[model samples]
Target: MNLKEIKLAPFIKLIFIIAIIAYVVLNTDIMGFVSKGISPVLTAFIIAYILDYVVRFFELKMKVPRSLSILISILLFLLILTTIGLFIVPRVVGAVSSLIKAIGNFEFDINALSQLDFDNFYLNEIQQAIVDTVTPLIQKLTNATGTAVLIVVNEVQKITSGLISLVISFAISIYMLGEKRDLLARIKRTLFAYLSDQTANQVLYASRMANKIFKAFFLGKLLDSTIIGVLAYLVFTIFNFEYALLIALIIGLTNMIPYFGPFIGAVPAAVITLIANPSSPIDVVWILICILAIQQLDSLVIGPFILGDSVGVSAFWIIVAVTVGGATFGIVGMFMGVPVLVLLKTLIEEDVEKRLAFQGYEGFQSNDIKNKKSRK
Candidate 1:
C-alpha cells in the first residue's frame, strides 16, 4: 500500500492512547504528578457523582430548584461528616483501645485444661502445645495492635495534611454539580470532534453503563450497609454486647465488600467478644447468632431489594472479581470489583453480539437464556 494512500489516523490515535497509558503506568514521575495534580479533581468528580442522585431527588421529586437541590445535598453531606466526626470516631477509637487492653490482659487457663481427665499422650502434647503457643500469640497480638495503631496515626496525619485539597475538591465538586449539563455537553462535543459517529456513540453508551453500574452499586451498598450497621448496634446494645460501636463499625465497613464481608467482620468481632468475656462464652455465642441473623436479613431482603440486578453477574464471577480485585488493589478494589466486572461483561456481550450479527451467525441471546431458565 502507498504510504500516503494508507489511513494512518486511527493507528496514530491508538498508539497515542497506548503510549499515554503506558507512561502513566510505568513512569514514577508521571504517576506522582497525577497523584498530586489530578487526585483532587478525581475526588471532586466522585463526590459530585454520588451527590448527583440526591440532587436529582430534590430537584425532580421534591420540585426544588436545581441550585437549591445542590445546596441541600451539600448540607446533608456536611451534616453526615459532622455526625461521624463528632460522635462515631471517638467511640471507635476508644473501642479499639479497650480491645487492645483486653487482649493484653487476657490469660489462657492452662489449669482448666489440666483439670480434664484425658490422659492420652496426644492430648498431653496438645495441651503442652497450647501452653507454649499462648504467650507468643499474646505477644504477636500486642505487636500487631501497636502496628495497626501506628498506621492509623499515620493515616490521620496524611488526612490532616490533605485538608486543603479536600476543601478544594469540595468546591470543585459543587461547581461540577452546578454545571453538570454544560460539562457533559462539552465532553460529548469533544468526543464527537475527534471520533467517528459510531465510536462516539459507543463511548457515550459505555459512559452511561459505567455511571449506572457505579451509582447503583455504591449508593445501594452504602444504604444497605448503613442500615445493617445501625441494626447491629441496636442489637448489641440491647444485649449488652462488648464494644458494640466498634463491632458495628467493623461490620458496616466490611459489608461494603460483597460475599465475604459478613464473615470477615464477624470473625474479628467474635474473637474480641470471646476474649473480652471468656467467663461467659455464651455471650460470644449470642453475638455470633445475632450477627448471623443480621447477615441473613441483609442477604435475603435488604441487599436484593436495594442492589437488585445492579451487578448482573453470577455468584461465581462476583467471588472471582472480589478476590482478584482485593488481591490487586486492596479494599477499594474489592468494593468496586463487582460493578466493574458487570460493566465489562455488558460491553463485551454487546460487542460479541454485534460481531456475530455482522457475520450472520445465529447465537443464543442472554434474554433468551434467561427466559428458558425461567420456563424450566
Candidate 2:
C-alpha cells in the first residue's frame, strides 16, 4: 500500500495517546506534581463519594431536602472524626508511649533457658538454639525503640502538617456533595459531546459498575473491620492483653487489606504481647488464639455477610492482586486491588462473551468450568 494512501490518522492518534501515558508514568517530576497537587481533590472526591450514601439515605428515607441531607451527612462525618480524635487518638498515643517504655526496659533472660528440664538431649539443644536466636533479635528490637518512637513522632508531625490540606479537601467535598447532580450532568454532557453515543454509554456503564463495586467493597470492608476491631478490643480487654488499643487500631487498619491483613496485624500484636510478658510465653499463644478466632469470625461470618460476592473474584486472584498491588503501590494499592480486579474482570468477561457471540460460538461460562472441575 502507498504510504500516503494508508490511513495513518488512527495509528498516529493511538501513538499520541500511548506517548502521553508513557510520559506521565515515566516522569518522576510530573508524578510528584500530580501527587502533591491533585491529592486534595482526589481525597475530596473519595470523601464525597463515600458520604453520598448517607446523603441519599437522609434524602430518600427521611423526606429531607437534598441540601439538608448533604449538611447532615457532613455533620455526621465530622462527628465521627471528632469522636475518633477525642477518644481513640489519645488512647492510641498512650498505648504507643507505654509500649516504647516497656520495650526500653525489656531484657531477654537467656539464663532462663538453662532452668528448663528437658528429657531428651535434642529437645534441650533445640530450646537452647531458640533462646540463642531470639535473644539477639529481642536485643536489636529493644535497641531500636528510640528509632521507632522517633518514627511515630515524625508521622504525627506529618499528620499535623497536612491538616490544612485536609481542611481544604473537606471544604471541596462539601461543595461536591452539594452540587453532585450538576457535576454529574456536566460530566455526562462532556462525555457525550466528545464521544459517540455507544461509546459514551459504555463509559457511563463502566463508571457505574466501578462505583457500585468500590462502594460495596469499601463500605462493607469498613463496617466489617470496625466490627472485628471492636470485638478484638473486647476480647483483649477481657484477657488483659497489653497495648489493646494500639493493637486493635493496627488490626482495624490492616484489615482493610485483603487476604494477608489478619496475618500482618497478628504478627506485631503477638510480638508486642510476647515482649510485654516474656516470662509468660503463654500470653503470646493466647494473643494468637484470640486473633485467630476474631479473624475466623470475620472471614466465616461477618466478612461474607457484609461483602457477599461484591468482589466477584476468586481467592487466588484476590491474593495475586493484593500481592502485586502491595508490591507496586503499598497499602493503598493492597486495599484497592480487589475491586479494581473485579471491575476489570467484569469488563473483560463481558467483552469476551460479546466477541464469542459475534463469532457464532457460545461462551464457556463459569458454571461450566465449575461442573467440569466437579467431574474431575
Candidate 3:
C-alpha cells in the first residue's frame, strides 16, 4: 500500500459515489424510476415493523407458534381496519354531503352580527364589510373542500389500480415476519464479522432501541388519536353539532401531531361550525371551548396514559423536529419526525454518557456509581 495510493484511492471512491448520487438525484426520469420501486418496499417495511410487535406479543406471552401468531395478528389488524372503515366512511360521506349543501347556500347574516353589538357603529360597519367579503370566500372554500374530498375518495377507490403492487408488498411483509429470526441472526453475524464484539453489540442495541421507540410512538399515537377521535365524535354528536363526524375525524387525525395538533384541528372545525350555523355564531365559540376542554383532558389524562415519555425528548426539540419534518416531507414527515428525533437523541445520549464514563468524569452519578464510590 503506497502512501499516495492509499490516500488517493479513498478520495477517488468518494468522488465516484458522489457522482453516482448526483446523477440519480439530478436525472428526473431516473429519480422517478427509483421512486416507483420505493413505495412498495417502504410499505412492506412499515407493515412488517408494525406486525412484528403483535407477533412478538403472541409468541412470547401466549406461547403461540410464531407462524400462527403472525397470521392471527394480520387477520386482527385487517378486521379492525375494515370495521373502522365501515363505520367512519358512511358517516363521513353523509356529513360531507350535508356540509357541502349547507355551504353552497351559506349566507353571512349581517343581522346576527349586529345583534351581538348593536350600539357599536364602527363594529357594525366592519361586520358588514366582513359579511360581504367573507360570504363568497366561504362558499369557495367549502366548495374546494368538497372537491378535494371527492378527489381523495376517488384516488382511494382507484387504489385497486395498484392492487398488484400492494399484494406484492404484503407478501414481502409476510416473508419478512416469517423469517425474522433467521434474518436477525444473519444480520448480527454479519455485524460481528465486520466489527468488534462491543461495536456490534452497540449497533444491535441501538437498532433495537430505535425500533422500540418507533413502535411506542406510532402505536401509542395511533391509540391515543383513536380515543381522542371517538371522544370528539361522541361530544360533538351529543352537542348536536353539524358535520360532527367530519370534524371529529379531522380532530382525531391531527391529534397525532404533538403540541399544535389540537389547535390545528380546532380552527377548521370552528370555521365549519360557524358556516354551518350562521344564525348563531355562538356555536363556533362553544365548539372552540369544547376543543379546549378535550385538549386539556388529552394533555393531562389520555396522552399520559397512552404516550408516556415515548420520545423522551423535551417540547422544544419536538417542535423543531415537527417543523423540519413537515417542511421536508409533508404530513408523513411530521408524523415520523419526533420518533426519529427520539432515536437520534437516545444514540447521542448513550454515546456521550459512555465517553464521559470512560473519562471518569461523572457529575450526576447513578446509584451504582455512588455505591462503588462509597465502597472505595
Candidate 4:
C-alpha cells in the first residue's frame, strides 16, 4: 500500500483502539442521557452567551462583581422574554380561537349564499372555490383549538416541566458564566497536557464562531417574527375584520418559515378573509392586497434588515437553503434546516479559507478548460 499507512501501523492500531472505545461509550445507556440532555446543554449555552456579554460590560465598565453582573443580565433577559410573551401569545391565542369558532358560521353562511343565484356564474364558482379551500383550513383550525384546550387543561404540568428545565439550564449557565475564566483555564490546561496549543486555539475559535451564528440566527429571527406579528395585528384591527387578531397571529407565527414563510402565512389569512366575506368582493380584494403588502414589507425590508444582518445570507442563498430544507424535512425541519446549513456553510468557508488554503490544486481550473477545448 500506501507508504504512510505502511509506516504508521502502530499509530493506526492505537487510533482504532481509541475509536472503538469512544464508539462504545457514545452508544451506551449513558449516551441516551447525553442525547436527551442536549436541550438543557444548548439552553445553558445560550444563557451563558448572554450573561457573558453582560458580565463583561459590568465588570469591565462599572468595575462590578461577576455574580451581580450575571444576575442583572439574567433578569434583563427574563424580562424581555416575559414582556414579549405576555404581549403576543394571549392575543394570538384569542385570535386563533375566535377564528376557529367563526369558521363554522362562515361555512354555513356560504351554503346559504348558493340560494341567491347571484347574477354571474363566475361569482358562484369563485364562492364555491373559496368555500372548498377554506373547509380543510377550518378543520385544521378546529383541531388546533382542541389541542389548545388540552394544553390549557394540562397547563400546570407543562409549566412545571418547563420551569424545571429552565431552572436547571439557568443554573448551569450561571455556573458556566461565573467560572468562564476558570473553565477556559482548565480547557487550555487539558489541551496543552494532551495536545498542542495551536490546534486547541483553532478548535476554540471555530466553536466561538459556531456559537455566534446560532445566537444571532435564533434571536434575530424571533425579533423579526415579533415585529411582523404585531404589525399584522395592528393592520387587521384597523381593517375592522372580525378575526383580525387570530389571522394576524397565525401569519406572524408562521412567518418564521424561511423563503416560503410568507406564502404559508398568507394562505390561511387570505382564506379566512375570503370565507368571512365571500359576498363582499371589494373586501376580499382588499384583504388579499393587504396580506401581500405586509409580506412584501417583511421580505423586502424587515426580514432582510434583521435576519439578513444576523445570518448574513443573500436572498438567493436563502431560497436555496429553504428549498433544500423543506424538501428534506418538511415544515418543522425547514425552520431549523436553514440555520443548520448556515452553520455548515460557515465552517466550510472558514476551513477552506483558513487551514486548506495551502493544499495544492494548481491545474484544476486549467485542466477543466483544456478538457472543454478537447471536447469541442
List runs of model 1 lying over 4 Å from the truth.
1-33, 110-136, 365-376
Best by TM-score: 2
Instruction: Tell me the tens digit of each residue's lDDT in model 2 across 1-376.
Output: 2223434465357546864774555455777867788899999998998899999999999999999999899999999999999999899888888888888988767678767979999999998888888878887988988898899889888996599899999999999998898999999999999999999999899999999989999999999999889988999999998888888888888899898999999989988997788789889998899999999999998998888777777788899989976776577668877887787777766765665565555554655542211331
Output the better candidate (3/4) by lDDT: 3
**Model 1: how far residue 274 lies from native, Å:** 3.2
Query: After superposition, which runs of candidate 4 have C-alpha atoms over 4 Å from their true positions?
Result: 1-38, 50-68, 81-93, 96-100, 103-157, 191-198, 243-248, 271-285, 307-310, 326-332, 350-376
TM-scores for the candidates: 0.83, 0.88, 0.79, 0.67
lDDT of each: 0.83, 0.84, 0.80, 0.71
Give candidate 4's TM-score. Answer: 0.67
lDDT of 3 at 69: 99
After TM-score superposition, the amount by which residue 203's alpha carbon in candidate 3 deviates from its true location, in angstroms, is 2.5
lDDT of 3 by residue, 106-182 (tens): 77765455457647788878877887777677667756756766776887797786777878888899999999889
Model 3 clash number? 0
**Candidate 3 at residue 80, lDDT?**
81
Give the clashing residue pairs of candidate 2, or none: none
Off by more than 4 A, model 2: 1-29, 114-129, 365-367, 370-376
> After best superposition, candidate 1 residue 167: deviation in angstroms?
2.0
Model 4 lDDT at residue 319: 86
